[model samples]
Target: MEQERDFTELSMMSKTRWNDNELRYFQHALSQLLPYVNPEGLTILHEINKEMQNRD
Candidate 1:
């Protein structure tokens, strides 16, 4: 789906300008999407986790 692709692309970005709330929302959305997403989605989740860690 286009939505999945869009999220995948956004997740791959090296510099995201999302604020704390936005990051939290994205993280939650990605988590909910895991069951229906592809293997690469796991990688995206990992990247997002790393971003969260880097911020903290």
Candidate 2:
């Protein structure tokens, strides 16, 4: 399988620019990636989760 790229870039982005659906999609994708992601990916996941929470 091809190696996944670093998720740290996602952290640099403004999640606010993403629509709710997009955020949800990323959230799901990140969840699936959780098992294989590195520490930075975990941070990206947390950032997405926080963004989602802020929306609610």
Candidate 3:
């Protein structure tokens, strides 16, 4: 299986013009907070993806 790259580090490299600076910062912050958002960590999204396709 392939491993996912870390998002916090990834978003840190993104550059934005002045208008989008806050969005860039928010994305970076959200990336770091993802691990703590759910007790299942990242597995929640994977488990739901297949079911989502069947729903819509």
Which of the numbered candidates is closest to the native, going by highest lDDT?
A: 2
| Model 1 misplaced stretches (Cα beyond 4 Å) | 1-12, 15-17
How do the residues 31-54 of candidate 3 rate in per-residue lDDT, one tens digit apiece?
577867676434433333433444
Candidates' C-alpha lDDT: 0.67, 0.74, 0.43
lDDT of 3 at 10: 39
The alpha-carbon deviation from the true structure for residue 11 of candidate 1, after best TM-score superposition, in angstroms, is: 4.3
What lDDT does candidate 2 reach at residue 8? Answer: 58
- Report per-prediction Cα RMSD to one decimal: 5.9, 6.8, 13.0
Query: Hey, what RMSD does candidate 1 come out at?
Result: 5.9
Cα-based lDDT at residue 8, candidate 1:
49
Q: List candidate 2 stretches off by more than 4 Å.
A: 1-12
Give the TM-score comparing model 3 with the true structure, all chains together: 0.32
lDDT of 2: 0.74
Give per-residue lDDT, candidate 1, residue 25. Answer: 70
Q: In model 3, which runs have C-alpha deviations exceeding 4 angstroms?
A: 1-18, 38-56
